[model samples]
Target: MTATTTADTPTAPQGHPRRWLILGVICLAQLTVVLDNTVLNVAIPSLTEELDATTSDIQWMINAYSLVQSGLLLTAGSAADRYGRKKMLAAGLALFGIGSLVAVLAGSTSQLIAARAGMGIGGALLLTTTLAVAMQIFTPDEHPKAIGIWSAVNALGFATGPLIGGFMIDHFWWGAIFLINLPVVALGLVAVVSLVPETKNPQGDRPDLLGALLSTIGMAALVFAIISGPEHGWASGRVLMTAAVAVAVLALFAYWESRAPYPMLDLHFFRNRKFTGAVTGAVLIAFGMSGALYLLTQHLQFVLGYGALEAGLRTAPLALVVVALNFSGLSAKWLARLGMPGSIALGMVLMSGGLVSIASLTEHGYGGTLLGLLLIGAGAAIANPAMAHAIMSAIPREKAGVGAGINGTLAEFGNGLGVAVLGAVLTSRFAALVPVAATSLPAALAAADSAEERERVTDAFSSGLETSQLMGAAAVLLGGLLAAALLRRAERAGDGRPGDGPAAGPDSPVGVSG
Candidate 1:
């Protein structure tokens, strides 16, 4: 349970005095990266017309960044831990800026996809190192509040992306969306160089080259298969082959990490119930939220006949509530009263209830979905900080980078899987109910020859959406129950509070809570 002092470990018992300033810089960096996740969603239509992009090209453009970023996260984190977090963060910002420039200049779909992939590399480094830096800067007592703010910024980014993108696309050009990242990147770079201290594991072993390669390849293949499944049938040869490769390589990765002296990721982390529960809860929450958002955006645009800007604006309530709760410290208060397990369980149940309410929507308008959005926002605000604390506290300070990377990777995987799986479900249900032969709602609407047929198509789409919501709700509810059970068991076994695990020590940057 003890830790050795290293050059990177903060000597001050209260941790870094400039921790708040450093957190602002970190949150800025994180916002830029997270904004890219949804900003492009609003630009899809513009790009289709401007670049003459095909459906396949458009999908790749969207998938490239996430696929590459998710694949490289573990490797990037391990590198940061071995080398330096601040250095890695600087490199990420520089690369991301360059990628933005490339994207702005891109006139072809292929060029844009390549630019996005490059940004993905930068995003992987940024996302992993940002959290690692935060862990190094803050004491355990301050961890929840810091993480709450960080989580709030994350929600803010997702919410603001569409609104920003929509405005830019309307007022200027499609490239303006990418151009917006430049100022953030420039400021982040300056702040990081001046304020953030270097941190790395002094006793860390040589880089696990083979382990990194296997992990990157496995994760990339898995994401590719998931992305491909909805566009091409799941049973298609390409998806099947890629999925098989992913499974085989990931299995090898597990075996290698278990035996390697300096594994890129330590397989033993999964043995800790707190870590496992937090990770599981993260994936499930991501799955439900991402899937719901994906469907709701479409429903707003196609079914309810809202513009991209309008749809984006309508989704603001969720983000607003999350931000309000986090900044007001209400979420932390709930965490204190409920404990980690109870808070996480309550949050999941709220989210599940929200999904159920959305599923029960009878009126085809935004008013019907308002209550559900508020519930989801509250749930996310309460659950995310607890989950982050549980996962990070279980990890040694030296390995904080990779631990954050693992968390990011699984969450990204859950996001991609959610969209694909839910999209598939909606498509299937629509097909069964629609009078037309089209598999998608847009296609069905276009193919409908009569007014009655169009009505039928809309009805079918609504029914499909309801079904998907219910499915997501059920999965999240079950996951919450299981995660709560595991976390409670860990506590009963004398793990102490989330921040008081084996990793807490005199030299530990994170503090131990009583």
Candidate 2:
């Protein structure tokens, strides 16, 4: 296979003046999907009140979305390549809009959960295709910059979701948040039809249907075990059984994909050290960041006695820093100077250091916590784009959708893992310290009917947060070390290239040697 050069890769022709318009449509879809990840948090109180939902039911409202999205990502990507990317993107947008509408009218807990799952399905389709379409329109030389912009927009969506949801909830009904996606989706649909060109792989082999089914079931089960493990004892029969099924099924998925005539996910991609290292680094950063955020939000609200909105507002600085670093064109300079491995290692170092700094945060000293948030934000800004570049550059252009799907799945998996692992640790440590308390912090807080018990629970929770942050720090540092080692080997083997380097000329292969 020959490497594709900038001239040979699809760079939208001059006649296609609508490429940027198509980008706008993709960004809108991307933002909607990213925002939904956290946008519903602001509506949790309303959901409980209006839907008469139990605590567990309310939690499922959030978890159900992630479960479906992560489970179907790879399937969606392969379907796009086998079918048509533009067609899938349009279908996804329509599905997302319909889900939002259904969510607005949902009257029961189960209905709301189902609506969220629908949205997740749409999100999986939309996100997987966006990058694939972008790859097809942009030349290899321009792909990194386009991906950088997409990453920046994605980060901005995550950052703003809470703020937007909070503001809507303050003045309007909770359904107003769901209503917000409608106009955006409508506009996206129009722009997509008018501007985006339909593209699919004519020579693409049949999708691995059995592989997709096994992957979906296995991934869903694994996420289910992880999400529920902290609430239900890890040793519980259900948890253990679910985990066992996940492991067995995922092993089967690997075996099937390896033998499939056309695998949904090519197992051989992992054979490339650069691709594996990039994936490892991405998952680690996501795990640490997600876990830290989960703890910090609780600390700000429960320990510091801040309102939900106040906590969201306080985290605004971190988002602002992330946007500045990712959008300022400085990342290109950093990537050029540090290279992919160095950039990821440096980011992880900053993030780990920041988590360590804030591990012992107190009620009165938010300065240290803020500094830590900023450092983590900066690290993410540098790491995310470089990771995307590395993974995409290492894969064949025809597999862009598969690459995007794998990236999305890893991110969601990392998030679920982080929350489960760190949350379990926090619960265990808090339970150990407070012998009479409930096994979990939330349970303890709920069971605390008296002010005295509440105070004790609060203190225990704070201690748990400290311990969890420390653990998160250590885990991320280990990831950084692993990334450095793997990347160094790639460099020695002459496969590692600076993130901003020009694409191999038209005659070269898509990726470097294994």
Candidate 3:
């Protein structure tokens, strides 16, 4: 079985008439997956009280979904390409709905974690297929605009997840959060079945079973190791062993893909600097965004002493700015003027600045953090669509599913690493400054016997957070520069102008290559 290039399949000259409607359905599916990623954060307290969940159980409940989703993304994407995007989408919806129902009915923390893992499977399929389906339905000329909307919806889900979850937990019950997914899943199924067209790689080869197994095990181990680092000591035997296994397995997976007859992921895609650069930007941005959100949520709840609902409400500005910029066409306009590399770099620069603002002004309260949130949101709006476009354009349409999967896998990897590494930094710094032996801020505060001790713990936590934010900002800033350099190098090699559309033939900046 030989590999087939995307050029083997001809693209439609025009997009589907119902493409916009289909996009809505696709966004709905995307929202469900993205929302689940963050929504559970607000529900942790409820679970602790309702289910008597231990610290380890709560951590697993949060990590299981991400671990499974990240691990299976490459396999799911490849499967969608081999089978059919519409079929995968429908199956994903059914599975996700079932998982949500199971979560709602779960009687114990173990059951909830298992349900989350199931949902992760569905999420992997939904995420890859939704983007792949969107690529199939839209013409290259309209990909940027379509991606802008798609990216905005992604931001919306992340931004609004806590708010929705907080509300559900406050008014109804913890189960309400999972229960809400049912209607969205049902509607998505209806729309997928009715409006979405079936698409797959016509020349796809036999299943890459070995490739899939290696990739899955490797990614799962990688995510597991990351999640464990902050909880277990980073250099502890368990974390070290897991990290080693992840590295060894992923390396083997990479080597196998290069030799496989029908590789699950094309190793050659990295040779395209634009694709690589876009992917780098995605990882760095996700790292910053995820780490910031994780810390900020704690900062709001613990340091500022806000209730869950109030904290969720306060974070609304981040999502609002992202949605506004993307929908107002300002993001598109910026993409046009700045080009792909320029846009990504500029967006990341703004994000770094936002993180810096938050780091420097922590003592000033919510008033100071608000501007940082808005800036971060604006940065994401400007960069995310361009990054998506660069990535999708570089892949042949035939492999769009796996392409989307690859994008997703790296972003998730970045997210996991951000939380783990930044969290570890915070923990280490806090420990160094605090006089208490408690492992966490909440624990330390509880252990504090006097007002002076409580004040000391709070100040230590705040200082640790500031240090973590500055570190994140520096990492993102450096990543932006490196991505810009890579994109510029690709242009100088005569790939084409950065501003050219994906339809600009083989000479285009992000043109698909055999």
Model 2 spans > 4 angstroms off: 1-21, 44-59, 430-446, 496-514
- For residues 389-454, what per-residue lDDT tens digits would candidate 2 score against the true structure? 887777766666777888888777676667666766776667766635564455667788888888
State every prediction's TM-score relative to the real structure. 0.91, 0.88, 0.91
Candidate 3 accuracy as TM-score: 0.91
Q: Any idea how many clashes model 3 has?
A: 0
Note the Cα lDDT for every prediction shown: 0.80, 0.75, 0.80
Predicted candidate 3 versus true structure: per-residue lDDT over 1-514, tens digit per residue: 2222243245434566788888998999999988988788777667766887644566568667876787778778888877778889999999999999999999999899999989988998998999988887777777788889899999999989989988887798898899999999999899888777777764555557787677667766776676566567779999889889989998998899999888877878888887788778788887877877777877877788876777788888989999999888889889989988898898889888888888888678777788888888888898889888888877766677887888888777677667766777787788789879875676787789999999999999999999989888887887788787787777778553222343322211112211
Clashes of each: 1, 5, 0
Candidate 1's residue-wise lDDT over 1-514, tens digit each? 2234533443443567778888999999999998888888777667766887644465567667877787778888888887878889999999999999999999889999999989989998999999988887787777788888988999998877888887887788999999999999999999988888787774555667787678768877876776666567789999999999999998998999899998877777787888888888988887887777777776776678777787788778888998999988899888989999998999889888888877786254566688888888888898888888888887876777887888788777667667666766786677679998864566677799999999999989888888988888887887688888889998888654333632343323322221
Candidate order by TM-score, decreasing, is 3, 1, 2
Sequence-dependent TM-score of model 1: 0.91
**lDDT winner between candidates 2 and 3:** 3
Candidate 2 TM-score over all chains jointly: 0.88
Ranking by lDDT: 1, 3, 2
